[model samples]
Target: MAKKLELGDPAPQFDLREDGGGTLSLASFAGKKLVLYFYPKDDTSGCTMEAIDFNRLLPQFTRAKTAIVGVSPDSCASHEKFKAKHELGLTLLSDETKKMLEAYGVWIEKSMYGRKYMGVERSTFLIGPDGRIARAWRKVKVPGHAEEALAAAKSL
Candidate 1:
C-alpha cells in the first residue's frame, strides 16, 4: 500500500527521460510552480482527454509561470507518439519503471471488472516554488480537472 502525501510535504524529486529525449528533473523547475500529474496509460480514453485538456490550457499555465509535467509508465517512444498525435505542448515524462509513481504515492492496486492490478491512480500534485506540495488531487475526474489545476497554479 502507498502512503498518502500531505500538503506542505516536500515534493519528491525525480530524473526521468522526456518524451523528446534527454532528462527532466524536478529540481530543474526550482523557481516555478509545477503541476505534476500521474495517469494510468497513454492514448487511453480518459488519459487522452486529460492530456488534451491540459494542452489546451498550456498558455494560461505558462503565463502563470507554472510548469506542467505528465507521467506514465509508458515508454518514451509511446509518450512521443501520444504528444504528437494530440499536439500536446506540455512536457510528458516516461516512468517505465514506476519509480516516480511509487514515490508520489500514485501507484496502487486497482480493481476493474472484478480483476485486480497494480497501476497508477489518476492523480495530480501542485508544487509550489519552494518545492513543497501545495495541493493534491487523487482519484481525479477528467472533466474540468485541467482548469482546476490551472486555477491552483495561478494561486502560487
Candidate 2:
C-alpha cells in the first residue's frame, strides 16, 4: 500500500543509478535541500518540457543552494540519450526496479480512455536539509511548475 506523505515526514530513501555511470543516494544529499521530481517517461512532451524548465533554471536553483534531480523508470542508458537529445543540465536517475518509485508512491494505477494501467503519477518532493519532506506535489502539471518549485526552494 502507498502511504500518503505529509509535510515534515522523513523523505523516502533511495539509491539508484544515475545517467553518468554513478550512483546517487538519498543519503548522498544529506544536509542539502533537494528538489526531487518524478516523471512517467523520458522523451515525452510534458516530461520533456518539465525537464527543460528545470534545466534552464539550473543556475537559479544552484544559487538557492538546492539541487534538482529527476527520476523515472527509464534505464540509465535511456536517461543518457534523453539528456543528450534535450541538452538537459540536470541529474537524471533510473529506477528500473521501481523500488524508489513505489517508495515515493508515484507508481499507481491510472485510467485513460476507459483503460486502467499502472504508471508513474508525475510527482515532486522538496526535501529539506534535515531530510524531511517540505512539500509534495502529485499529479503535477508541467507549466510553470519548475519555477514554482524554485521559489519554494529559495524560501527554504
Candidate 3:
C-alpha cells in the first residue's frame, strides 16, 4: 500500500473521464480549491446520500471557490445514471483503472461479515488552490461530510 497522504502533501495528479462524457484533470483545478471525494460505488445507499449532500451544498462550495468532484471505480455510464437519478449537481469521475485510488491510498483491504476483501474506503480530500492537500478524511461518515469538507475548504 502507498503511504497515507498527510496535510500539506502535494495532491496526486489525475486525468480521468467524467460523467456525461468529458475529461477532468487535477491540473485543471490549479487555481481553485477542490473537494475530492472517493466513494465505493454508484447508486449505493451511502454513496448516493453523500453525493446528494454535496449537491445540496454546491452553491456554498462555489461561493467558497471550491469545486467538488466525486470519484469511484464505476464507469462513466454508471455515473451518468446515478447523477441523473439523483439530480446530483457535482462532477463525478470514473477511475476504472484504480490507479488514482491507489495513489490516494483509499483502496485497501476491508472486512464485512468477517470476510476480508479489497475495496475503496470512503475518503475525502480537500485540496488547496496550490495543489497541496489542506485536509483529508478517511473512512468518512456520510451525514455531514460534505459540510465538513466545505468548512475546511473555506478555511483554506
Pairs of residues clashing in candidate 1: none
Tell me the tens digit of each residue's lDDT in model 3 across 21-51: 8799999999899999999999989999999
Error of 3 at 156 (Å): 1.0
lDDT digits (tens) for residues 1-156 of candidate 1: 446889999999899999889999999999789999999999999999999999999999999999889999999999999989988897999998888999999999999999999999999999999999999999999999999999999877
Model 2 residue pairs with clashes:
none
Question: TM-scores of all models?
Answer: 0.98, 0.98, 0.98
Q: What is the C-alpha local distance difference test score of each model? A: 0.93, 0.95, 0.94
Runs in model 3 lying further than 4 Å from the true structure: none
Error of 3 at 53 (Å): 0.3
Report the lDDT tens digits of candidate 2 across residue range 86-134: 9998999999999899998899999999999989999999999999999
Candidate 2 regions with alpha-carbon error over 4 angstroms? none
Which pairs, if any, clash in model 3? none
- Candidate closest to the true structure, highest TM-score: 2
Rank list by lDDT:
2, 3, 1
